[model samples]
Target: MTLTGHSLIAGEAVAGTEGRAFGINPSTNEQLEPAYGLVSTEQLRAATAAAADAFKPFSSLEPVRHARFLETIADNIEAIGDELIERASAETGLGAERLRGERARTTGQLRLFADVVRRGDFRGVRIDPALPDRTPLPRADIRLRQIPLGPVAVFGASNFPLAFSVAGGDTASAFAAGCPVIVKAHNAHPGTSELVGQAISRAVRDLELHPGVFSLVYGAGTSIGQELVADPAIKAVGFTGSRAGGTALMRTAAARPEPIPVYAEMSSINPVYVLPGAVRGDADALARQYVASVTGSSGQLCTSPGLLFVPAGEDGDRLADAVARALTGQAGQTMLTEGIASAWQQGFRSVESAAEVELLARGQAGTTANAPAPAIFSSNLDVFTGNRVLHEEIFGAASLIVRYKNVEDLAEATDLLEGQLTASVQATEEDYASAAALIPVLERKVGRIIINGWPTGVEVGHAMVHGGPYPATSAPSTTSVGTLAIHRFLRPVSYQNFPQELLPAPLQDANPWQVNRLVDGEAEIQPR
Candidate 1:
């Protein structure tokens, strides 16, 4: 498959008027062929307008067709094969095995949403029969169901290029909710984004759906993305990146004449609390696991355990020593980009310069431009509690061990944390009684709480939540992963005293879709 480097707008390949940008391989620092042109503001408007035109027919489609459309997208993505993996691997510096798994996750999420559509629960249908014979005024019949919020603007992420990029979760969920999507391709992997974007376009064509159902735009800077968010046709936005980028989009959306929701997954230093029992039981094992989690994908994961809180004592000291020993055996790994690598180095230097922070260990040096050496640092409770810099996420291959003197110190540290995507407690059965007190605090601070586990791996399922409070995400009530993510692009509408023929199939008297629904506040599954 040859790369065109053109933006896909309304099913047509359109060239950008702005300057061009090339995809560079992070490992070798080599530029890939075919410079991608930046989409102009006019192109952005055209894409959004196309999406607005596509919304009604696309959203009003039968649930079965929606499921088939999502399934077709998964098939098209799979058909792209090894070329997809190679381009993504070169652009993002992620290994072939990792990209392959991420590709599977990307397609799996699409199929999962397809299943979600087939089940029809996303509609959230409810009905209330007319009570003409009862009450003083005779109650009128009412029906309710969730409807799509129109076109959505999605920003692709740099780290997980396949699973969070052009045709990833945001696009899948938006389509599942019956909204048209316009994706802003991440600059780091424009080729990869183009490939996936084309795959989705092929799916749209195969299904004979609206050509405006999906569009992909590339940009050399933020202008195109900002324009998309500010466009009147775009009803919502989905973003995943740095705090600065996410918050900027939030501000842009808020400043719009008609403000919209921005579901942005921003920075998170997922904290791991090491209970007394776990630290004392096997410090070596804990150290090994912690090191592996921190260094995974060069610590690019949003749920990476960047902070570890351990009870201060001989046990904590032993654990720190074990971690230092483990770190010495690990090698420096390639990051997603040169910018990220530079930022990691600067963050490591900042930690080293801190007065009370002690450098534990450093990984073997790398031979490339974008590789990052892993480092571990430790600080006492007093220094950690007083320094706000200690709380910021480093974004790569480093973690801070904060020694807490007692449970009170741990509570205080937890209180100092901002909202996070995940928070974990490594405890044994014996530590349950003590760990119970911290559960409520963890619940308030993070989207997901893990017990005796790491937070790096996010499962895509019905119950998973990849969102949290401010700084973690703009909206805490919604998730950016799993089947529930579809809800973010949906809003409910109630039809009162409507004719049976005018009602949507799901809310009709016959329940034509045969979906489980609430009737007069009671669960009902029977047709009519």
Candidate 2:
């Protein structure tokens, strides 16, 4: 596939008539060729209009057909092969091996949603058959099923270009939910976005689906993203980026005449609490794993453990020493972008200048413009509580270790944290009582809590939740990963006294889809 520097708008390779932007190689600090033209207001309107026009037919398609379409998209993405991986690596500075794994994760998520569609569980079909033969007040013949919430605007993420970009989970779940999607390509990886966008367009065409079923737009700044969110034709949005960007979209979506749901995955520190027993048992091994998680992907993941809580004593000192020793051999790595590198530097400076924070260790500095030196900082509970800036996300390979005097101090530190995508406890059986006490506090503070595990790698599955309350994401009830994410683009509609012909197949008495559904308050699996 050729890298056309054109936006895939309404199934056509429409050239953006606005200003142009080029993909920058973060590792080399060099601009990539074939400048991508930014989309104009008119083009944005046209794309949304096309998606709105396509929504009816797209959403009304049979469940089986929807499943097939999703599978086709997965196939098309895989067909892109090495070209996709190479472009993504060059554009974002992510290694080919990592890109290949991300590509598999992207396709795997698409196929998982396909299976979700085939199973028909996302429909949320429920039936309460009317009892006309009953008392004076007979129950009305009512059935409920989830319907698509029309067109969705997806924002490509800077990190994980393939897995979180144009054809990533947000788009996949939206498409699986039968909603038309218009993705705003991330500026950092325009070439990768173009390739994946073209692949999706090809799948839409090969399936003979609506041309407007998918579209990709490019922009140099926030104008296009804000306009896309404010468009009345867009019913919901999916975003993965910084807190400022996500909150800006949330405000825009909320201020619109007809407000829409914005599932914006924003910031997360993903705190890890190291219980005293666990820290005492094998601090060296724990330190090794902790350093690995923080340095993985240059600490670009949302679930990266940015803050670690440990008991202040011999155990804590041992852990800190182990981390310092581990940091000596670690080397600086190239981040996803120069802007991110700058932000990391600023965040590191903030931590370094804090009154009680101590710079425990520093890795070898990188020789390139976008490379960042990994650093570990330590502070006591008093200093951390007094300084809110210490809690902010650095967005790079930097973490802070907060030493607590006791379990109460640990709980206090945990309470001070903002909402996070995940919180982990490195504990053993002996620490269960202490770990159990922290679970309640963590439950309210984060979405997922892991025991004796790292929080960096997020698995896309049925029960996985890549979301949390408040700053972690715009909407806590919905997720941007896994099959449940389909609900973000869906709204339940109850059909009252509708004839079989007028009702959806899953809601009809025939139960054509043969899906498990609630009937009169009981779970039932009806035959086709």
After best superposition, candidate 1 residue 497: deviation in angstroms? 0.5
Task: List per-candidate RMSD values in Å.
Answer: 1.4, 1.2
TM values, all candidates: 0.98, 0.98
Candidate 2 regions off by >4 Å?
Answer: 526-528
Best by lDDT: 1
Candidate 2 C-alpha lDDT tens digits along 134-237: 78788899999999999999999999798888989999999998999999999999999998888899889988899999999999547999999999999999
How high a TM-score does candidate 2 get? 0.98
C-alpha positional error of residue 64 in candidate 1 after TM-score superposition, expressed in Å: 1.3
Range of the 10 consecutive residues with the lowest summed lDDT in candidate 1 = 519-528
* Model 1 residue 455 distance off true place after TM-score fit, in angstroms: 0.3
TM-score of 1: 0.98
Instruction: For candidate 1, give the lDDT of residue 163.
Output: 92
State the weakest 10-residue window (summed lDDT) of model 2: 519-528
Candidate 2 lDDT for residue 412: 74
